[model samples]
Target: MRTTPVERPTVLRRRSYTWFPVVSGAGFYVAAIALPLEHGDGFASAILLTGISYFCWLIGWNSSFRFTRTHVSVTNVLVTTTADWRDVAGVDIEGGLAGLLRDGRSLDSIAFGGSLIGEFTGYRTHRRACRLLRQGWWGAGPGRRGKGPVPVRTSVEWRRALAIATALYVPVVLVQGLGG
Candidate 1:
């Protein structure tokens, strides 16, 4: 038998959404400086607005679904959940793209917009993303490797970027407490 090389993970995200975070972050940063200077809200307000800008940038830039040979990882605003191919029961597209686990847990994906937004737009985007995820799931299923059902092992990790963004607001709170 021939030995094959390991494959790299495939990441899925909306290309059209790439401009939102940058534009919004810049807008918020400008408002942060302008509001405090024009309206005299003090440094606390400016810092709080800057924190919100960082939060938007962090969430928009870091969230996506990554599919590897062994598992599928869903990255949301702060938490990332990775489920093995054998642990995933199926894909749920009713709300958005979600992975239903055999252990009765569901990991929601941020790569697709929610159903509320889809209700106005007709769910075309959600359907297409769901199809891609389902294809990856079947392509990496345990049956293809001749493996039986194994114990469900789902792992979760909180991204440090979120903590950094949140920490931006601490100085605002401290400044406000000092009666600035």
Candidate 2:
């Protein structure tokens, strides 16, 4: 577990995929052994079925990764790569959150949950990080050069909408408070 300096958490996560392993194991156990369609020498068939099921599950498991507040972690069954958010220059959301760094290297965030690439969904987490970077909460370290350009899309629009909505509501509340 690498350490980071980010004090807040962004929305970067890949949770919808971890369930694939669980579902495959359970489905195979229930279908092939627990309640076989036909009862006749299922021992050999069950072993093969289990092998295939676990293979698919393992494949899904190894491909998922996540983003923490200060770091983005990409993992495989054997290796995991982590990059600090401070080094990111921009986040390209074409197919996934591709973090472009000031050093000219880019990392592809784990895109699971049918997130446009059949498995690349970290929309919320990506948005929060964009918002934080735009707010300067997760960017270049002082005295040290890091931080890149603002992501193409930032969360300020959402904040603006919220402000407009609040403005509309406050006037109504004020009117009610002064009148009979």
Candidate 3:
């Protein structure tokens, strides 16, 4: 008899929202170039527009959730955190999949996370995504009983990537505010 080996972790993403960013990013990128040419605007407008485009692209392409037998990794717009199964108290579905920690903290998810408009419209995808995440959490059994430390670490690389995106807006804001 042959036993099956463990497979890869399940990855969940908001595939439906992908096009919004692509279109939005393209629009902003066009504006970044067109505004500088037409209005002869300073670097501020270009910087702001390009920053917006980068953020849109990042949200569309980078955010995701990976659920493994031992842990769950959540990648949001700003950060990517990996939480051990034992640290997860439960799953929260406030139009997205958020992990409720045993210590009363909540880690929000961007992938499959809905906007206020989508929530009001009662989008079904959030519920489905949450159900799958809940199943993975419960199946792991570590949340109830596990050994060793329950560590939740944020990826340094992801932090740096988001920091660069945020930095793009800061200089433009400072320059504009200083009357430059």
Candidate 4:
């Protein structure tokens, strides 16, 4: 009996330096807890915590980019987009990291771009990865190139969680502020 061949997945992730966000998030959380206990009311603490939470969330969420032989994926704060390589028209690194799709919608990558914060965010590695991805690797689509089509899928649980958190945060802060 003949068996079907299996394709291997090539996963490339962000190569960010860890100290900055980790240290900053820790500092903010510590301040959030300490500031309130020391002098301010719970309202102040709530706002501080919310701000820090949002910062940490973005830092954690948008810290990677991944691609495979079949599909390409871009992750940003709260969302990850996985699309067939064929679906992507091209990549744009002009303002930052972005993927232009055949549908005209662009997918932006968080940690994969050049920015003023590059010094602290380890954007160099991401920039290199972006270059590598744009190197005609996804030229597997049919028609002009005559390659083939790739199936794709995406996950949004993190985005949903972020949305839910944002929704709950406002109410919680308001209640605490008004209660006492």
Clash pairs detected, candidate 4: 140-148
Candidates arranged by lDDT, highest first: 3, 1, 4, 2
State the lDDT of candidate 3 residue by residue for 30-122, as single tens digits. Answer: 766555333436566778797888888778766778788888888876578888777888998876668877767766776666588778867
lDDT (10s digit) by residue, model 2, range 9-106: 44434455556665775576444343343445454455555555554444454444445545654544334566665666666644555666667766
**Lowest summed-lDDT stretch of 10 residues in model 2?**
149-158
Error of 2 at 11 (Å): 8.5
Steric clashes per prediction: 0, 6, 0, 1
lDDT, model 4: 0.61
Against the true structure, what is each candidate's TM-score? 0.65, 0.45, 0.63, 0.54
lDDT of 3: 0.73
Q: Report the C-alpha lDDT of model 1 over 54-133, residue by residue, as the tens digit.
A: 86765676677878877888777666767777677899877666877776677786657575777776666667667877
Candidate 1, clashing residue pairs? none
Candidate 4 lDDT over 56-144, as tens digits, reads 64666445566666567776655677876777878876656666676667667656555777646655556666676776445554533
Model 4, residue 132: what's the lDDT?
68
**In candidate 3, which residue pairs clash?**
none
Stretches of candidate 2 off by over 4 Å are 1-22, 32-41, 59-62, 67-70, 109-180
Which of candidates 2 and 4 reaches a greater TM-score?
4
Error of 4 at 52 (Å): 0.8
Q: Distance (Å) between predicted and true CA of 180, model 4? A: 15
Better of 3 and 4 by lDDT: 3
Using TM-score, rank the candidates from best to worst.
1, 3, 4, 2
